[model samples]
Target: MIEFKNLVKRFGTRTVLNGLNLEIREGEIIFVLGTSGTGKSVLLKNIVGLLKPDEGEIWIDGEEVSQFTEDQYFPIRKKCGMVFQHPALFDSLTIYENVAFGLRRHFQLSEDEIKARVGKALNLVHIQGVEEKRPAQISYGMQKRVSLARTIALQPKILLFDEPTTGLDPVTTTAVNQLIQDLSKKLRTTSIVVSHDMNCALSIADRIVVLDKGQIVALGTPDELKRSTHPLVKDFLEEVLHA
Candidate 1:
């Protein structure tokens, strides 16, 4: 459902993504594994038009969107839901309002419809009984789930998660990874998760793409990656093995 061809992204003197090409199938869960400064997040932004590539094209559902104007990208962005490294929730809004915010702004829905979507989204993330609570009143992990609830409320076809497991304890991280797997199957949405956790990738990803500097150094399923002889892939596997 998504394809990048000869993609190149640069920031003044630095080229973060260089001649990268990747194709993601619909209903697939892809894990992007890379160290910092490897253009993992940049790749996600480019997909949703939050960032544009300097060279080559990005195709989604057979449409080339590299040169799409903001208005042209409106629907594309709407079809994509991104969960950032941090839960960028409004401190002032209750969890219910936060989840309902996108629905209110993007679609003309009745109060009853909005309420139902918010409830369902929360339930999909395994969250419950915190609708009236503000962000500050919830645990950090719960707050993250609320953020996810907000994204899924829009019923997006593509889910872009940048460091979804960051800042969580191991137990919470494992739970979140399993949730990603469950949601992908339940909603049949394409998921691209940018993370450094090879362990989680192995447990949940349909495939893993490892990036180095600006290129894909390795790409394979978890078992293939585990058997890979590439030095960087070996290093990542070692970390996972010893973790």
Candidate 2:
């Protein structure tokens, strides 16, 4: 459903992503694993046109969008829903309003339709009640779920996650990982997750792509990665094993 060819991104003297190439299949969960500054988040941003590639092409659903203007990229962004590292929910908006915000803005739906979508999205994330409460009232994990509820309520065909479990405790991280897998399967949307957790990736991802210096160093299923001999892949595996 998504492909990147010879991709490159730079900031003045620094090249973050270099000659990166990969493909994400439809309805599959693909985890991108790398240490800090390996261009994980940059990769996600490039997909939704938050950042443009300097040298390569980005193809989504067969359309090359490396140079699409902001207005022209609107439809592409509508087809992709990105969950940022921060929940970034409005403090004043109630949970329902927060979830319904995108629906109201991007779509022309009645109050009843909005309510139905809000309910279904919250239900998918296993969040119940608290519709009238604000972001400050809920637990952080629930807040994150509400954020996810807000994104999925728009019903995008592709889901992009940038460090979805960044600050969570281990249990919450596991729960969030499971939720990603479940949502991808249930909604039949292709998922691209930029994360640092290899253990969770092993248990949940259809494929894992390991990046080093903005290039793919290892790409395989969990079992295939277990036998990888690359130093970076081994380093990641060591951390996972010793954890």
Candidate 3:
């Protein structure tokens, strides 16, 4: 489980997260929804230990992550995986090499083991035949799949997705959404997604947490969010519904 207790982060005069408190349980898919600049991405960065909180504690499975040193964070980071808004693949590398990048850099595995792991990761995302192909050769949807394959290759206990379906068409968006849900269930990994796309959120989120000005304004399942009486939520939902 991941818990953020009274977390606070500031950049000079700007406050990104203000006493942010949240709980993410194991094997659950949690979605953080908000308008742009509401600090949703910053919250994800804190959870992954990329940024430090100026105040309060972050606990991952009972360990005080806020107090962890760089060395301590290394092992913890391995247990977490992240998929950025962009596919973020290296254009020069083949799909096989891209997926194997982390394993080679972080682990002491042999060539045979690396190959096996890379192949398995690709197969998990239905991209087995694209191993030798460069990332630029594939469609945008396929690039996203390759990115997901790289993330799952780490076998993280928690997966953080930042707008996974942002640029895809409705069909591709639906496919990516289903893939997120399927991969979360199959791997039993805790999934946390940050998105403004209600379709993606409603499709895959087991629970939704809405933020306004860096504070949680509502938390509930998809149905509850859709039927919420809060004007702020209703307005946001309506905008997405129409878009």
Candidate 2: Cα lDDT at 157: 99
Task: Choose the strongest candidate by lDDT.
Answer: 1
Better of 1 and 2 by lDDT: 1
RMSD, every candidate, angstroms: 0.6, 0.7, 1.2
Tens digits of lDDT, candidate 3, 127-234: 768889998899999999999999999899999999988889999988888989999999999999999987778877999999888789889999999988877789
Instruction: Give all candidates' CA lDDT scores.
Output: 0.95, 0.94, 0.90
Candidate 1 TM-score versus the reference = 0.99
> What is the descending lDDT order?
1, 2, 3
Model 2: residues with Cα > 4 Å off, grouped in runs: none
Give the runs in model 1 whose Cα sits over 4 Å from its true position.
none
TM-score for each prediction? 0.99, 0.99, 0.96
- Candidate 3 global lDDT: 0.90
- How many clashes in each structure? 0, 0, 0
Q: What lDDT is reached at residue 54 by model 2?
A: 98
List pairs with backbone clashes in candidate 2.
none
